[model samples]
Target chain A: MAPMRIDQLTPGTVAHIVAIDLDELGERRLREHGLDEGVEVELLHRAAFGADPLAVRVGNACVAMRRSQAAGVTVRVAQRLEAAE
Target chain B: MSEVMTAPVVALVGNPNAGKTSLFNALTGARQKVANYPGVTVERKAGTLTLPDGSRAELIDLPGAHSLEPRSPDEEVTRDVLVGAYAHERVPDAIIAVVDATNLASQLRFVLELKALGRPMVVALNMMDLAERDGFFIDYEALARELALPVIPTVAVRRRGLEAVIAAARDALNAAEISAIRSADAPAMLVEAIGDMRGHQRQARDIAAKVVSGGDANQMTRQIDRLVLHPVSGPVLLAVILFLMFQAVFAWATPFADAIEGAIGWAQGIVMTSLPAGPVRGFLTEGLLGGVGAVIVFLPQIVILFAFILVLEQSGYMTRAAFLMDRLMAGVGLSGRAFIPLLSSFACAIPGIMATRSIADPKDRLTTILIAPLMTCSARLPVYAVIIAAFIPDRTVGGLANMQGLVLFGLYAFGVVGALAAAWVLRLTVTKGAGGGFLMEMPKYQLPAIRDLAIGIWQRAWAFLRRAGTIILVSTMVLWVFASYPKAPDGVSQVDYSIAGRIGAGLEVVFAPIGFNKEISIALVPGMAAREVAVAALGTVYAIDADDEELLEVELADRLRGAWPLPTALAFLAWFVFAPQCISTFAVTRRETNGWRWPIFMFSYLFVMAYLGAGATYWISKWALGG
Candidate 1:
């Protein structure tokens, strides 16, 4: 259960969205973007540059978020997995 | 079907932070115009896509909204456009609802609402990469069956899944089942059903379990945030970043600005040598070259300024800075929502005013609009550069930072102060009700795409050049005519009897109390078009008959210091801080507010403040100097 930075999340990993430790503005933005409790997300890819903005698949769409804000979002690794073919 | 006859209109809608912009940019390529301003999109941006059949499909990116219920003006606009409530435009033929793949439950709520609208609709599941990393699996088929819409996974930044999105849109459009919802049955049952369904959140969970897969948290971000977000370190980091921004503006832009100046000088030399000594030569040299070149020389500074802003915005640090300033902004009657728009005002006020639509409270929005222009914009950069270069001694402060850069930072600080003070006063007098409460979202930080960042910067630079070429061009020509006409008597200086000089002299009677000379008065008149135009106008007016290649900065300073006192120089700078001068800003204010009353009040109040502020600065400077 090592606490990992959001940017290191790779595609195909499943984690629960724990919490978004952001300012009021950032908090509202997180809610607006559908990053809340009970929601599971998958890391799609890091943007090309070394910057922290990443694309994550939430529900039926992929959205980008900054690494700093994502760091505040705590998540537990999902246990369920598809059997290797 | 005669598919080639008419283009299909495809509307893009999504909750904020749903990667709609990335998707739009991916689809439209270089055809985006940033309809309103940075950080906020209000108007519909239309771009055409050539279908395989040679029929064109028009793609329209609508403003991001949380719900179709429409809480704010921006949301209402989205609702109206979707509902075909707009007076001029027809309803879109197809809807592309972009949803964050990781945050499906809430986003699906909006999709369900859109489904109820009965329009041909498809869901673009953007940010699939992030979803996989977070270990969320989405069963597109199950979700599609549940919502009864085509679902496509997309990584907009990577330009992935766009084809599927387009194909789904095409399929939806061709199907005749897409029609407006006209059920006479009350929506109360649907609302109740939705409320009840929330209890079975497992519906979304079950679908997600079926489709999405593989997301593991990375350890690096956690380790870094511990140090960066530390209360003491966070502010320090922000300060360091800002210091670098100003330093870059001066240090990096000097050589480029000098190159442009040299080029303009070479062109001016050619015009003087080739053209006969007549009105045409004077017009080319003084009016066109002097006026335009003076403004263009500052282009490097403009580009560099945007470079810093764009990088910061893309890095995701800007939102953090705004978050830090939220408490402070609230003390001055501004909501957290005002931060983005006000930050944008530093580049231009038109878009800043338009960005106010995001503020739900009319009073807060109006107050934000009124004070936005007080923020120092790119247009004010030339004037500040000229004045600072002329007056402020260029020495290092604390043996580390350049004194000139600090002064430039101070000028920006002064504008922020002026905006806050105005907002405070307006809250008490003009605007009614309490300021809107803060509710903002903080998106997870991810690396910014270099291509998108580059495109954003280029767009800003293009806009700056367009303004310089058109509005500044015609105004400079007219200024030349005014300052060139009414030839002086045999012995009198040519400018002394010219139309501009006479007008300035008459106006000086009023401005003299604040220590401004006739020339300064004349220049201030055209400053209303834009602040930087005043610098160009001054160059043209003073260089009307000059022959030497001496630096314009040194010459202008010498002339001003000889004709007017130091108090006047200081007073003029103070006036700019609160000046109700930019006519274009006022026009934008009128458009944003949809009335003349707000603009009129803003203008009159700002004029009084500018006069009083300048008058005060003059007296203080005079006393300090013992003049």
Candidate 2:
């Protein structure tokens, strides 16, 4: 219903980027890797340690970034895929 | 047309993992030249390509970049070359913009950015096989018309569509004069595109939405990542992979290393009997064979290590490994990017130091380079082996591990701990700045091609061998001259009378506080050439006349046991664990950092660590053992 940080999205949840709050450089880098407003993304995986870094599927590509970087991106949930488990 | 003319330059540009390098390798096969761009450590990889017309074009592989907006030094090079701003590199007469055919929507964003420059360009829709396998179909004709550039589907790894791609490139070059006139209005195109990435993305998405239909790609990658990045299984698999790689680096490479050593020894033996026993013979056996040979012996290990690194990188597992190690390395203020370079340091710091180029943040790369030598490289192995054999007893400790083996393991552990500690401190001080963030793309995994692996390993091994031939060769010869000159008087030992001996005698005073003897002091001089040479220098200083290799080790070990106390032996091991003794490492650091500044700082800090580490070891052992 509301925009959430990509880091806060549950695994298997699909979302579209609403806006990026990172510094100019970070935002530019994220956009260059196909992360931009209205682009569909899915939360795919989180690293083992503390889950600080996350892997998000941007378009057809997978991007790994720390939570700090991912927190800058605000996204609106589109749908939650059924968990196989 | 028949007249001879300079080859037109065609540059291959792409985003990372777009198969640009594989295409370059396939087209230029074995004609590649990799060198550093002038005034920067970024590599310049160029090769000659034969056009379908039997004419040649210089195909330069520009460093992969996401956009022309310069974020890193590598990106700056790519952007500069594309915009005709880099002074050292020629402007490409035609550009081949490589994009992944599987995910054209995202990759076309970069191709759209490249089109703004208006260079006569062809679009290489690479990885077409994967796209087809994943159930994607594209109207290449429509895509070509939409972009106003020739779009050629290519499977670069299989050398598919190469001739057509080259023929298109030749046609683009033929149309370059007209394109140049068209580019008259495209001035400062990069500046405008930098601020309008959203526009490019929208246009690229529009183009893809108009002409492409496909099922979900990268499904296989997602499935594998499920297990490979699982909370429990991910780290375990990473650990297993790393352990196996290290094992392969050491165990699998041992016989090849032994063969190389045997060949050098055989060469030395021939020189020994063929030449008269004089300066000429001494120089050949000691300087040329011993100095260069010792460094060359590590080639097998480097090749093995690189074979693993190249595979992991090509298979896209390297990024995953970096992702797994990120949080742990973050404890030391380094991103996970430092993990591969630091791991490589165990084989040899040269490649490890060079590998730091992957790190985008300057401070993070600097910190990694400074701590790389503390990883207890394979050169330190022979020194540790000799010292551990001489002092540590053969008896078992804890009823399972041999005492010597335990000590050897401890030395490795010590080096790793010391490296982490140094990194921690350096991050707080010299390399302190904005902390680097871990932001990487995890590409779909594919089997590494055997040809690419061979080329990668060959390039690294050749760089190492070149160092051995130049810097290592020179330093060894200088040390040999110092060690051999002014033969001893009738009674005095040759080493005691030589220039190196006198320097050792003088250095002994400075080293005495750390419990180093005159023989150790003398060996330290030649050790600057390489760590392992210290062992051979010690043998000569001890005046053990054993010609056979096994006899030398046995007699030298016994002699060391009788001559030095246990504390000194332990101290020797401690010094090597931190000492900056390799000149080749310094040379590479200078080349990497582009000056003497960082290498000087590295040398100074490491010397201090070695002094403190050795002194502490000597005193603690002496007091603990009542020696």
Candidate 3:
């Protein structure tokens, strides 16, 4: 599939960050968390009741962010290498 | 240490939850002071550590951030200190860049940025033990060589590698002069020179590849997350955790509270015999012990509550809870970030309001602050316990839940709903529209460190005790004076003739609609300082009104059972739920916001809400089951 906003990915899919389109504050904050372009990320889970804030793994840290926040970052969906296994 | 032999300053900086705070605690031990960073609201911690060479060095715990690029006020403090832009703080002579061994690729880039400031630096590979246990080995020496800084492996939880860290810090400080490290002219534009963050990111990855021998994703963490973050089970688990936390707070703290209360009573007996029957002895018993000791009894509950908070925070589950709660809170026009500060309000609104500093948007932060007091704080526990004990019968429902306990839970639920409703209203009226985006880092899961948890619990306990000693003491003495003066016109009760009594009588006209009698109105005056004082005040009123000396020893709850009508009891509980009785909350609101505007507004709004809420409860109860 083509690259899409990080919030678009469902649980268990892995992706690499492509770019962040955000206001200055949001951009600065996300960039500080090592979410710059080319960094690998994986969608971990969504919240239980209303799955708005998605917990995505960035590097070794697990970050929880709302889709409104995650909408800024575009992620290139990782190819399913696990399918080979 | 002499002023001439001034200790050098070394900063410990890292991404949040990299164990930087634990490393600081291990290194500095108990010799640390927490203060606001000059003008900013960011907490600045500095501690003294004795170096191996028998000289002391100052350790500064800089706010955690991934890069020098400032995002929030906290990060701005770190950036300013590092770049020598903050006027009040001198640039640290050396920086200890604390990095997690498991998260080298991301953490090392931060170290790279810190190095650009051109100060003597070392990498403290914190949580090395956790790394090795999870099956990885790092060539720390190679990491050091690649970055041109020393690398020390530290297990901060176990106090391992602390000596090596201190020695490394001492060496760095000795090698670099403080004056040389800091120059107003030195223009720390060196970050751009070393290359932008992207360049450093690639270099950090290459360095990580060389130094990291073998590792896998944390398997246990992944499994825990699978269970903890599941859509169905996660929210249920969170509710259970919070529910049990509240249940445990009440269940576990009773014995300790009773023991402490007995000790105070015993001490009062001992001191009573030595003093003459005069004002000095009376002051010691009533103003100091009675007033302050009322709060001290609740310390056990506060400690129990904080222990759970500290453990959850340290174990990295709090962020997951934030993610879960954000869904509901978002509908009320608050970001998930406000969940923490608001939750903390259950223990006390002061810290809850203070905790709002981490919320990035000012509008969201202010709105959260305005509604924090609506959440029932621990101070309200004594009032509720007394009322519930008096009015509600001790019957178990479903053979498991006690009726009184269920009512207490209902009050907590009411507080939550009230806070949500207040936030919604405040967002519509007092704040800008609340669509602030929240992006919080969920730290990797680890067992909460025993030492860190102990420190956290101790810090909170000390803070509570300190408040009891100062604020609670002063307010008690002032109210005692108000309750004691004018010699109580001949043959009249002391409180009846005093200023407090007169004011209470005057206020009774206003409170009558809400089912408060003259005694309850009188109690509300001191209750402004602390909520529990109202119970004691009522006890005094009844004791004097009955003219029975033995009445002083009787439980106020028993007295209330016969005195107050059922509707009055309901009204009182409703009043407490909405009333801004504690002056301390408003005082703190003033300090945190740096003005009187929010506190005054908070007080006025809460008073109106309390009166209305109580009036409705009283009338409704009377109508439903005639007064």
Provide interface RMSD per model, one decimal.
Answer: 10.4, 1.1, 1.8
For B1-627, candidate 3 gives per-residue lDDT tens digits of 235766678999998888999999999877788776554456788999898878788899998876677655567778888877888887788899999899888778888888877788878999998799778889998888999998999999889999899889888887786446554534646556234776877788889889897777677888898988888888899989988887787778889988987887777676677787566776676667666776788889889988998888888898878888888888888988898888888888877887887777778888888899888888888788779889999888899767877888888888788888888888888886757777887776878888888888888889888877876677777777777676676778787788878998899999998898877898898788878677656654554444323433555678888889999999999999989998878877887778999999999999998999999999999999955
Q: Candidate 2 lDDT, tens digit per residue, B1-627?
A: 225578888999999899999999998998999987776667789999898778889999998888888666678789888877788987788999999887788889899888888788999999888888888888889999899899999999898999999999999988984545343344477777666888988889889877788758588999999998888899999877766665565467679877987897789778877888666876776667766665677678668867888898899898888888888888888998888788778768987887787678999988999999999787787677667767887887888656766676678779988988998999999888887798888888899888888888888788768866776677666767777777767767777788888999999998898999988998898788888778667755554222334431344467789889989998999999999999878988998888999999999999999999999999999999997
| lDDT tens per residue, model 1, B1-627 | 335566778889997777887788888888765564232346557777555555668898888887665658888778777777654455678899998786666666667666666677888988888777767677778777766778888999889987788777778767733453333232443354334323334454555555556544433333444444445575578778877877888889999988998888788788877888788988998888888888988888878877777776655566566555555666777765688788778888877787788887789899999999888888888887877777788899899888878888888888888889898888888886765555444454567776677777788788888888988888888888988887667777666779888888998998888777777788888878888889888887787745445433344555555556678877888888888778888888877777899999999988888888889999999999998
Give the C-alpha lDDT of model 1.
0.73
Which model scores highest in DockQ?
2
DockQ, candidate 1, comes to: 0.10
Off by over 4 Å in 1: A1-85, B1-4, B33-41, B176-229, B545-564
Q: Where is model 3 chain B poorest over a 10-residue stretch in terms of lDDT?
A: B543-552
Tell me which of candidates 2 and 3 scores higher on lDDT: 2
Docking class of 2: medium
* Candidate 1 docking quality: incorrect, acceptable, medium or high: incorrect
Against the true structure, what is each candidate's TM-score? 0.83, 0.90, 0.93
Error of 2 at B15 (Å): 1.3
What interface-residue Cα RMSD does candidate 3 give after superposition? 1.8
Clashes per model (N, Cα, C within 3 A): 90, 0, 0
- Candidates in order have lDDT scores of 0.73, 0.83, 0.81
